[model samples]
Target: MKSTINTSQLITLPDGRSLEYIEYGDCSGTPVLYNHGMPGSAFEAQVLNDVFKDNGLRVICPNRPGIGRSSSLSEYSLSQITQDCFFLLESLAFNKVTVIGWSSGGVPSLWQAKHSHTQISQVILLSSYSHFAELDQAPSHFAGQASVLKQVTTRFPALGLLACKMAGYLLKYMPSLYFKLLMQHCHTPDSDIIEAHPHYRDMLIEAQKQSISQSASTLFMDLLIQFREWPFYLKSIECPVTVFQGDRDPFVPERIGQHLADCLPNAQYHLLPGQGHMYWFEKSFQYRLARLCQI
Candidate 1:
């Protein structure tokens, strides 16, 4: 399938905030809301443009506040972000949508499923973080700078903000080194996949660049929110959810996905063997998505 790269469009919210978003695939096709990962932006959706177009899926990927061209908020909750998404859907006249949340985006996606169950048809979480408390319980299970960053961000936010700023600087000025450092702790498959696919690597680099294009403060707050306790219970989400996790993922443990699936009343967990965090870019994922949408 040919790739489609649509320019971002902006929508002004009732609260006077501008939310920037990118659309992919057929305009009149099946509606989908894609929640990008942390250090990611709407551009992340471009990686899957071919799959979306092939499956006749209309994907609406929005940049969270403080990312991309969206208006930054001093104080915002996951619920507010979810509302922003719903408002965008309303403006687009999309009454129902399938939500796909990757990494940190899963929190707000779950919020959407819980709060707006009527409008949400289904949800898919890819290598997503479950809960901060869950991680705290088994600190040893997760390792590397990501774990340390979470701990620092939870206890010393000021330091965390500084760290995020440094990361943003690296992403903006020294992306090559930034990615090199990032892949240092990644599983072998993850590194190999990135090295093999230049498009995928470029997509990720661009997403990270856009993520901190405005400021790193929002990124810090995003991390803080993820570290703190979530407001909703997993069991409260009535919509069917499918959780995908790579067993070799270094950042998010496979058991976390299982635990999340166990909590949800209607959720299925799929563990991908010999896969890593970047497994979503594989053909298997595209096939799964096509099957799920019954295309």
Candidate 2:
């Protein structure tokens, strides 16, 4: 809740959008740029930032274009987000950096691998799919589950909005509930991570509420756009890539992660046991990242 970390001012994007990010650890350290998942804030990887901080590795997490104190892009696409992040990297003068993308955030990372592979030293994707259509495999389908988001507005619009607003309030106070819900929805076991960090639950919830205002349809569309002929991009990427997928992931079937690993020429694939999308932000993620980065 209270942060002693002093974050610099927001960085403006080429599209006139502003992104808020936190920078910490030694500036001379190797830069590790982190992108958060959909409906998540810059704080989504707060736990990972903490984990990687002391190792002389610089960590950067922007507000992901819209969530916390960041400005929204009038027209958004994963390519544009990746370009913006590339500019940010240029501004920082980090000639090369490692990229870590988690879940929906992996879209932009994938874009980078396809379009800006030269700038990347390595890419680490967690619980990421090769294409967007994989959303059908995702465990939590707000569309199929309840359509509570769409139906509530018609049935009890006022109460629905109020509940969303309240949910936002509760988020700031109860981050743990958020993480638990995410862990549950991920439909994968994370007992090792769970036993270690109980407080992450509240942090995760805060992240969800922070970006909850975004339309669900638009979020779904993001994956749709990414899915259509997505494999082509994988074939084009020449950089070193690594993927960590949760075998039990209800959202992305293990088949996809397997197919991707087999497709990429320089990819190292790992099917993390009893994990899911949340693996990216968990402490366990470090082992994978460090191994891939050769740190």
Candidate 3:
């Protein structure tokens, strides 16, 4: 499959901030708005390009503010970010579309589903974060680390900013080392999946590299926002929602997914056995995409 990396386009929002995005797969097919992960960019969607093409689906993947070439915001909320996404959709004349959020991307995706239920046809969350209230119930290691980071960042914003900058530097300069360190936290299945697919590894590395190509301020802001209390209620989302969680995912354990599903009024929970956080890179994800296409 051809790389979608070079197909990125830019649009100027009403506030004069530039938003960078990429459109891949069947352009005229069913539109799907993809909200990439926190430390991700439009390139994250490259891994699903083949599935998107085979399923005749169009993907609109955008880089959040301060990531890639998108203009950074000194102050922004999830609601404001959601508005940016909708503004792009409105500019494209896409009145209704399926929304998919992976990891931290799920926060804004949930906001989109809640704030604009009339325009959202379906919502899919992949190993997404639920409310901060559920953090205590998550895996101890993941929850503890998250809690510490949130506390540290809250108490010392400069330290957090420094850490984000260091991470960005590592991603840009020593991506292999960065990937190696990142995989240390992954389950065996996630590492095995990446080892088995060299292309997927490359895609992930490229995505990470692009994520902070501009700066690391976005990463810092993303974590800060995620750690804070979400402004909306899950029960407010009345649209059909699907939550896919890997039983072996270390970052977002199955319990977190279950909690998110239980909170949503109309959500179906799917627990994939033996899968990890990066399960989307596995072949099974294509089958899931095919089934979603039938909806």
Predicted candidate 2 versus true structure: per-residue lDDT over 67-98, tens digit per residue: 56666666656666777788888887877878
Checking candidate 1 for backbone clashes, the offending pairs are none
User: What's each prediction's TM-score?
Assistant: 0.93, 0.75, 0.92
Arrange candidates by TM-score, highest first: which order? 1, 3, 2
- Name the candidate, 1 or 2, with the larger TM-score value: 1
**Model 2, residue 113: C-alpha shift (Å):** 1.4
**Model 2 weakest 10-residue run by lDDT:** 141-150
Question: In candidate 1, what are the lDDT values of residues 1-295, reduced to their tens digit?
Answer: 4445488999999999999999987676788899999889989887677777887888899999989999998796786898899999999988888999888888888888988947888999998877767555653546444467678999888899999999999998999899889889799989888878877877888998888888888788887887788776677889999999888888876867777887889998899998878888877687677567542
RMSD of candidates 1 onward, in order = 2.2, 6.0, 2.6
Cα lDDT for residue 70, candidate 1: 97
After the best TM-score superposition of candidate 3, give how far the Cα of residue 114 lies from its true spot, in angstroms.
0.8
Could you say which candidate leads in lDDT? Answer: 1
Q: Model 3 residue 186 lDDT? A: 89
lDDT of 3 by residue, 1-295 (tens): 3333338899999999999999877776778899998688888887777777667778899888887788888786787798999999999999889998998888888889988946789999999888775554445424424456777777799999999899899888888898888899888999998889878777877787777777777788888887777766788889999999988887777777887888899999999999888888766786686568558
Evaluate all candidate structures by whole-model CA lDDT and list the values in order.
Answer: 0.83, 0.63, 0.82
Instruction: Please identify which of the two predictions, 1 or 3, would achieve the higher TM-score against the true structure.
Output: 1
